[model samples]
Target: MLLAGEQWAARFEEFQREAWRLETLPQYLMPQESEELQEFRDGTRIDPATVHNEYTDRLRRQATQGRLQGRVHIVTRPLAEYLRFEFAWYYAPHSLAGERIRILDVTDRPNPLDGVQDFWMFDHSEVVLMNYEPDGRQINREVFEGDPAKFIEYQRIAISESVSFEEYVTGFDL
Candidate 1:
């Protein structure tokens, strides 16, 4: 929703309200420090604050990049856990000492016309193989990478194996 812009992105206050709402749900199970205020009274609050700042920074960078509306998928259990932890402590209520959040320091990428393109290639970090469908849907599969150079070779193979389109314009107006 953040990627689609203001209309789809929930305001901070609204997002907080939703998180609280989620807490009230019967089936919602959260970690110890995130379950309630009691969890933090006995432990340290510094780590959670750092993580919260990092998450906020990530979102801020994405917003600035015009990729704020880009979709994020928690593919692994650890990733999901961290997301929940960040939201529950830093974002939802800052249960640990009311920590302040900040945006991340993200690098800039080239624009669309700059000849560089972002493709749905394989990602080792996420452990998934990305394949595009004719209707624009993406198919992610689990694959192994024994050789580092296999990525370039596989991309070449896929491109050669697929059909492509071309435009035949007969007139031009300068």
Candidate 2:
């Protein structure tokens, strides 16, 4: 059953709070940027509105495709280097609400190196990343399991194709 109108509002509020609480730590978080975002920043100047449109388009596409099933929770973290400028954006699943229960974000660690207890819900089959890299590329991490090293490799590929910071924040799906 699809949550509509007022019911969705309540559910969304609950999800937001739950998402924030779950994502409050640093270790569970993943890096946002890849070399591609750097290339975009180095190559051109982009406005926040443009970035917003990019994300909106992406999400609209996803919505149309029905990929955004359930109460999908999204958390976007800004990436900065040299503590000077915000370079990239990180997107992760904070929760998934549906009968299948495909994904869930249970922790808020900022960097993945902090050693997190990976929650293998539903037999470790539902971990999917829509935007795995700072470049705005989407991916599902479940396919790359077994080899820990391949996880990072998959991330690298996703980041290489991710969208810009502007797109990530404003244009793309949050």
Candidate 3:
């Protein structure tokens, strides 16, 4: 079924062992981040030391507790402005906060998981499909409980083919 608002928020708190996300978009339109995004577009940069949210706090807690929380974002060269902001402001802090971030730069190589959309695989048991529009507006999350084997495999493939956030960023200009 479709999950949005509180339902989407609940998944993070509910997942026991791991909350793995496969991010296929270069940017995301987050309502709560409208102002920040706009400022980013206007040329203000986010200080990693000051960038934070409840979500990153949760990531810290999970990491301290020996739980896994991470994601793989597929990106191309000449990064999107939002992505520049996200990596500089959002992803950097999240990584420092103990969330594992990987990048799949498919600017040259063929995407191994071309057809896969964004998704969250919880504890390798359930999956939540993250639906988004062309401009990166989130439509809603869809929960899939039947069998998550495919998603689990996708995670494996992503991790194997991707590089750590630090390595990836250092190789780029952002």
Candidate 4:
């Protein structure tokens, strides 16, 4: 079934134990990040002191409350500029706020988790696949009616093959 708009997106808050995501996109045209993306392109660096928001605040709360929240972003070396900017402004701060961030760099090796698009697997039961246009504009979220096992396996493979965002960054210039 297709879930549209804020109502569906808000499902992130309903996860009880875990809310894990697999990010396979090089860029996402998120409207909220427009100004930040521009500043990033203009060569300004992200400042950690001012990155907190209601979202990150929720992440912190969920984390301390023992709920697992994280994502493994599939990427390649010579990272896309957008990915770099996102890491600097979103991933890093979110990690610090208690959302785990992992990177599955597919630079020199074959991707272990191939053919995977962005998705959120919540509580190991519900799976929501994110649909995006070729240019990375979000279309909508589709809830899978199939078994969650496949998505769960993908999550395992991703987590096993990836590294923490901090560790991943040490190998790059970002």
Strongest candidate by TM-score: 4
Candidate 3 wrongly placed segments (more than 4 Å): 171-173
What TM-score do all the candidates reach, one by one?
A: 0.21, 0.26, 0.93, 0.94
* Per-residue lDDT of model 1, residues 71-164, tens digit only: 1111122223334434445443332333222211112422112221122222211112333343324333233345535444433433333222
Task: Tell me the lDDT of model 4 at 53.
Answer: 92
- Stronger candidate by lDDT (3 vs 4): 4
lDDT against the true structure, each candidate: 0.29, 0.30, 0.88, 0.88
- Ordered list by lDDT, greatest first: 4, 3, 2, 1
Compared with the true structure, what per-residue lDDT tens digits does model 4 show for residues 8-83? 8678778899999999989999898999999989988866556789988998889888997999999986888899
Candidate 2 Cα outliers beyond 4 Å, as residue runs:
1-36, 40-43, 51-56, 64-79, 82-114, 117-125, 128-140, 143-174
- Least lDDT summed over 10 consecutive residues: which range in candidate 4? 43-52
41-72 in candidate 2: lDDT tens per residue? 57543442334444345444444444442221
Q: Name the better of 1 and 4 by lDDT.
A: 4
Model 4 compared with the native: what TM-score?
0.94
Task: Report clash pairs, candidate 4.
Answer: none
Question: Model 3, 50-103: lDDT tens per residue?
Answer: 756887788888898888899999999878887888898788999989889999
- Model 3: lDDT to the true structure: 0.88
Give the better candidate number (2 or 4) by lDDT: 4
RMSD of each: 20.7, 14.6, 1.5, 1.5
